[model samples]
Target: MTTTTTTSDHADDPHLIGPFAIVPKQDCTHLADHDYTLPASAKRVDGHQPPCTDCDAIRENWVCLEQNCSQVGCSRYQQKHMLAHHQNTGHNICLSLSDHSVYCYGCESYIDSPKLVQLNRQLVEASN
Candidate 1:
């Protein structure tokens, strides 16, 4: 995905030097038959934000969206725990906890589809 960086409003914050927005792919083949809701067997976290299962990071976290797997992990920019999860389990897709963005590791891009939009909305509501 192509990313464009611009200055952030919070100039005083070192981590907020700029905002990074990823230009997502229009669709993903893997999500063609995805069930938009979390599986019944999926365990829900108690709070709105949960830490990564592998590293306990609260920021830039992602939840695996393969089958009944809901494993949370730190983003690639942090510890790459999600990448490691994909490598070990072959679970391709994940949803970002911070922004509700959907990503497909197999496709190597963020996905932006009608179904994904619905799914992201469902997740946001579920989290709340």
Candidate 2:
């Protein structure tokens, strides 16, 4: 399993507190109709820490939440490939493969969803 460490730069942001980013709200317009379901084609091709599609860094990777897109990319703190994916495809939501934390680039914040958490839990369990 991959581990996440909080950096000093994130200390100033109240919403990014703790070992992980804080979920300010539970509602996200982009996920308002989302079912938090992974596509049938989705699989951990590279185990828990998949290499970013745009780069070799895998420590801070994330998977796109868009149903048809299973693209993985390093986090903004690394290569920003996931952000680039969002910019290029307008697919704003992603789940951190490191911690299964849901984030919406459109909302620019962490999002809370029990269903999503459960789904990620299942994914993790299956992988083990």
Candidate 3:
């Protein structure tokens, strides 16, 4: 894992409210279509499941914007993004990219990785 945090574009946006920032109005459940299902070659090498067994957010192969690190897993991408937020926001704590958990173990209820976009949409919808 890259411990080298960037003060670059990955830094906190003054616009966001919490550690878990939403992309605003982007639908989480239905991301832009990718034609067919993800091929076996597209799977994460990390052994952790992608698309989230819980939310079913990623059903296709959407590559990460970051070159060479093109992870297609919605949960993995979200977790990595949130991990950066958690690191920068003074909420520094145990975060596992492998486990993709923001909270401590034995806890019930979690903010679903894919639902963050839906939450953003709701906020957008509510404000309008």
Instruction: Give the Å shift of residue 121 in candidate 3.
Output: 21
TM-score of 2: 0.72
How many backbone clashes can be found in candidate 2? 0
TM-score to true structure, per model: 0.69, 0.72, 0.19
Candidates ranked, most accurate by lDDT first: 2, 1, 3
Q: Who wins the TM-score comparison?
A: 2
Better of 1 and 2 by TM-score: 2
Across 38-100, the per-residue lDDT of candidate 3 in tens digits comes to 233234444433453234444322323221232333333454443343334423222222433
Q: For residues 16-95, could you state the per-residue lDDT of candidate 1 as single tens digits?
A: 32365456777578775756654332334565457788888777888887766878888999999989999999888888
Candidate 2 segments whose C-alpha is farther than 4 A from its true place: 1-21, 39-48, 114-118
User: What value does the lDDT take at residue 59 in candidate 2?
Assistant: 82
Best-matching candidate per lDDT: 2
What pairs collide in candidate 2? none
TM-score of 1: 0.69
